[model samples]
Target: MLVDLHSHTIFSDGRSTHAEMVEAAIAKGIGIYGIADHLCFHDNPWTTRLDQFEEMRSTFANLKANTTSAKILFGMEVDYVRGCENRVLRLKEENHWDYIIGSVHYIGDWNIDSNAADWEGKDVDATYTKYLELLEEMVDTKLYNIVAHLDLPKKYGHFTDIDFTDRYRAIGEKILANNMAFEMNTAGRIKICNEFYPRRDIVELYHQLGVDVTLGSDAHHRNNVGQFFDEAVALLKEVGYSRICYFEEGQKRYLPL
Candidate 1:
């Protein structure tokens, strides 16, 4: 069963409408497909506006009722900002989403993945450390079901000389403690990094830590729905993961890979 829990539509930065993305997912044989568009408190070009929630909820309701080929989920990739907990919580409460994916794309107003210029002559190690620290804090909030793109700092192919094995393990521990899962986002393969999010070694460490995982394409275009899913499943199996997880009515569920 192919369960892709992360995708986008015109609601965010995606290139297609919700209907188009769902049709593509059906064609791709996705068993359970989720459309998790970007949801951030801060105003941004790629995030869905707070005012559009009601319309999106209604649209999802209609899609769930009409779509029969695959199980369509109403999800949101919510950004984890330090002072935006209440806003996120309120959104979750009002929407009653099937799942909420928490992600950290900004570090003190610096959009880490925006461009390589953000890393100019700065302390790469400190930035990496800060990202992990924020990741841990996001998990600690216990407000999210899955963490999107575990190692986002590598999106621009940036690497830190300092070893972060312990840090990765610590994040895994926190996810386990909070009963949250991290997604093996495949979008990274097309990014400058040319690798999957949460590198192979990190996946192996998570497996060792007994942390759960889910699959996400992070697709912004209709054609990319369930993109690279076969490779992702193969990698998970190689890392000793026999099953992958998803959520239903805000409850976590699993399916064999």
Candidate 2:
């Protein structure tokens, strides 16, 4: 079964509507498609407004009631801001989501993935260090079902000479301890990084550490639904992963690769 669990719609930064993305997923032969639009309090254009939350839920409900070709999951990609634990917890309590993808898009109000211009004059090593620190904290919250776009700070080709292998392994171990799944986000391949999120070596490391994974295209447009997934599956199998995971009402389940 082909499952692409992370994607967006007009409710966030995506160009496609929910229905349009579903159609594209069906055409791409996805057996389980999840709509995980952004949920953030950052007041950015990409963040879904608080007022639209109910609409998103209702629309997804309508879709779930009508669509049958593929199993549709209601999800959200929440930004992991340092001082916003209460907000995240409250949102989690209010929504009945199949999965919640925790992403570190910001480091103390500095948007990491917003654009390359924001990266100017930044200390590469410090930035990487901070990103990892936030990731560790996000895992400790024990509030997320999946980690979205691991190593997202590399989105703009910024490099740090410092080796963070040990730190990454610690985080991987924490993720496993928390029973959170790692996400192999394919959107990075289309970005300037020209690679998948977490990188192949990280994927291999996670596999060796016994961290289960799930696939996500991070598609913003309908055409990109399930994009590069074939490559993702091949890479996972090459790394000794014979199966991938999905979620149902927040419970993790596996499928053969």
Q: For residues 1-257, could you state the per-residue lDDT of candidate 1 as single tens digits?
A: 79999999998999999999999999998989999999976778999998888999999999999998999999999999997889888889999899999999999888888778878876778889999999888988899999989889888888888889998898899988988899999999999999999899999999999999999999999888888988999999999999999999888899988
Name the candidate that leads on TM-score.
2
Segments in model 1 whose C-alpha atoms lie over 4 Å from true places? none
User: How many clashing pairs does model 2 include?
Assistant: 0
Pairs in clash, predicted candidate 1: none
Candidate 1 vs. true structure, TM-score: 0.97
Off by over 4 Å in 2: none
State each model's CA lDDT, in order. Answer: 0.91, 0.92
Candidate 1: count the clashes: 0
